[model samples]
Target: MKFSRFAILYVSFSLAVALLALGLQHFLETVPVLSPHFWLLFAVIFLLTGLAYGLSDIGIRKGGQVSILSLMGGLFLKLLISLVVIAVLIIKFPENKLLTAINFFSLYFLFTLFEVICLLRNLRDQNQT
Candidate 1:
């Protein structure tokens, strides 16, 4: 479960989820299209989460206080970016505010889950070695 492998997995999984959502949106109107900017939100979530996890993995591999600092910094950076993106969307698309918020939060939760799982795997590997 190296960081590189996990990153790739995250990207692939994100894409699959996006496709599934798109397909579902066709059948169920409530599925949330993320309209006006269809795939942008998905891309952002994947990229940001992958970047954060990859950087955290690098820091953890180095070992020491750096690991804790990088982990916290990565989490903070991710949260900041998500908030900023959501806020910008809110301002830009006032009419679709609810749909936009729901889409962003859903992606955030999914990516966060991916991040935590990868980090936990890193931690277990570190403990074993």
Candidate 2:
């Protein structure tokens, strides 16, 4: 997929997720289901996913094994950065460690799924050509 197309789709998806998160947090205001730093987590995950997608797309355009390597590398870097963020959050906010971790992973998986689907579509298009 083109970078422009990916950016549009990704921004849309991020906005939808943000809206859903806002609704969920509002509905569960009394409960501590969501972390206090929800927006920070959202921004971090969003930027990481976009960066990874861009890296993978560039790799795909270059062809051959570079594509797979770049995809894997991007994912690995995302994971590492996410882990560091989680660790810092847990240390700084010990009261809501579990909630923060859960929310972080939830967003991580959701974005990863979207990234995979888009990449697969791109690969298919490349193969067809």
Candidate 3:
């Protein structure tokens, strides 16, 4: 199935903001860490990442899957999107920028890991017909 225009817009907007976030991370080195720009850029990254996940969810809805795939796809796809965003940041300007990305990845990894385990635990494969 084809995606709606809003879905396309979400993908575009997320990529643009994610790209801008890499530049903003570099600029943060010279400005006050708590400056409006820092928080503003951070918020943009957060929103864009969320929109990317929303796009993923939309795609999943348009398709079909059962069992493991449905449970794993959401986590994996979001991680994939987040990783790409971070990778682009490092590739465009490689350095300790990886420091920030590393911390974020660790936190996200643990949280999503917890979520996936909890979701899987809720299902009983042996009893299902």
**lDDT by residue for model 3 over 48-96, one digit each (tens)?**
4454444444444444555446545656666676667666666765655
1-129: candidate 2 lDDT, tens digit per residue: 899999999999999999998888789988876788778988998999999999999999999999999989989998899889989989988987888989999999999999999999999999999
Between prediction 1 and prediction 3, the one with superior TM-score is 1
Candidate 1: list runs displaced more than 4 Å.
30-33
Q: What is the lDDT of residue 51 in candidate 3?
A: 47
Question: Roughly what TM-score does model 3 have, to 2 decimal places?
Answer: 0.43
By TM-score, how accurate is candidate 1?
0.89
Report lDDT (CA) for all predictions: 0.82, 0.91, 0.50
Error of 1 at 60 (Å): 0.7
* lDDT ranking from best candidate downward: 2, 1, 3
Candidate 1: tens digits of C-alpha lDDT, residues 1-129: 775688578868887888887787887876556665446887787778878987788889988999998898888899899889888878987877877888788888988887988898888989998
Candidate 1 differs from the real structure by a C-alpha RMSD in angstroms, to one decimal, of: 1.8
Model 1: per-residue Cα lDDT at residue 49: 86
Total colliding residue pairs, candidate 3: 0
